[model samples]
Target: MKRIIPLLIFCFLLAGSGCANKAQSGAGIGALAGATIGALTFKNKASGAAIGAGIGALMGYIVGNEWDKYDEKQVSQTLEANQSGQTSSWTNPDTGKSYSAVPSPAYMKQGQVCRDVTITEDGGEQILAKACRDEDGVWRLQQ
Candidate 1:
């Protein structure tokens, strides 16, 4: 219970960051999960949490990186295809995690094309994200 309090506080602090990227979010969530599991499983909570956090961060980074790529691709394709209100889904074969994205209509912002997308994960987590086209014609998440 004491450990959980600190983790909750950490998460609240993390949430206060306005422009958190995927890796940061992943690391924070992963660390929290790792610490909880470690505290419950090991006699030495501190050591377990340290080891678990490291492993969790690594795994989270890899997974989050892949998800970022996948999102970019999906968003780009949706924009190019001009298919607003369409739902596209994909499943990672390695992890068996499924994801879906529904893009809103594309609009112009400061002469740049932008879109809002609602992404849903297999476990029902959802995030609303904004993506914009760069000068190089590549779509990137808006900070």
Candidate 2:
């Protein structure tokens, strides 16, 4: 059917998009699911799909952002406990994604304690990340 072709294409695109990041992956998945539901639930399939996709994307972004926060928390904890050059590792219970971080020595930046870290994901790509501890002693990832 005509509808089936587009849906299949969308799914393929979604699969590729998921590789980007959690927020993006969530949006792609949400849009696909929303479009399917909207097409089935509404008389005007096109309009319904559009509206549903928008709503779904927003919701998905929120959920995905939370996941990001959770990951950041883990990274912060690792930085707090491990010594410089010692790798700290953890696996996310929710996503089964594993990460390891090796933090550099703590240094002062603009009066805040900061550390540079190398974080490896699933033993594959490694990303350099930075985190700083505030007065309240919470370690926050620096952009």
Candidate 3:
């Protein structure tokens, strides 16, 4: 019962925070996953859960903090509203990371609008991505 109380408190805090972005959501997911893994892998379930939660939260924060709604909007607007050669750029106020996206001309694929784009992050890292417009008219990045 005592162990459950701490976990409940943790969950309550996570829920109360509103989890307005990916980082918060990641932390919540990581905490749950870590707790499960820790319980299965260690003799001291509570201690293991605590350690796992810490590690997982850090990892999740790092991964999920990379992008947010602003970044998504920048990419989508650049692809949908501009010409092939046009580029769009934005800087994240919280992280100080700058991003730029350049998109190729849109083409039709299986009744969907598709485009290829190159995104530069922090002025050095670059990623090539493909995106397609869905039935709801939202552009989604392809895996």
Best by lDDT: 2
What would the TM-score be for candidate 3 when compared with the true structure? 0.61
TM-score, one value per model:
0.59, 0.72, 0.61
lDDT per residue for candidate 1 within 1-143, as digits (tens), equals: 55556764574456345455566667677766776677678798777776676676667667767766765686677666657888888776655778888889889999999999887879597888888889998888776
Query: For model 3, what is the error of residue 71's alpha carbon versus the real structure, in angstroms, after optimal superposition?
Result: 0.9
lDDT tens readout by residue for model 3, 38-107: 7668798777777777677667666666656667778888888878978888897766789999999888
> In lDDT terms, how accurate is model 2?
0.78
Candidate 1: where are CA atoms >4 Å away? 1-22, 29-63
Candidate 1: residue 129 Cα off by (Å) = 1.9
> Clashing residue pairs, candidate 2?
none
Per-residue CA lDDT of model 2 for 1-143, tens digit only, reads 36544754674486366344677667767777776677678898877776776677677767777787778888898889989999888887778899999999999999999999998999998988889999999998886
Q: How much lDDT does candidate 1 score?
A: 0.72
After superposition on all C-alphas, the RMSD of every candidate to the true structure, in Å, is 5.1, 4.5, 9.3
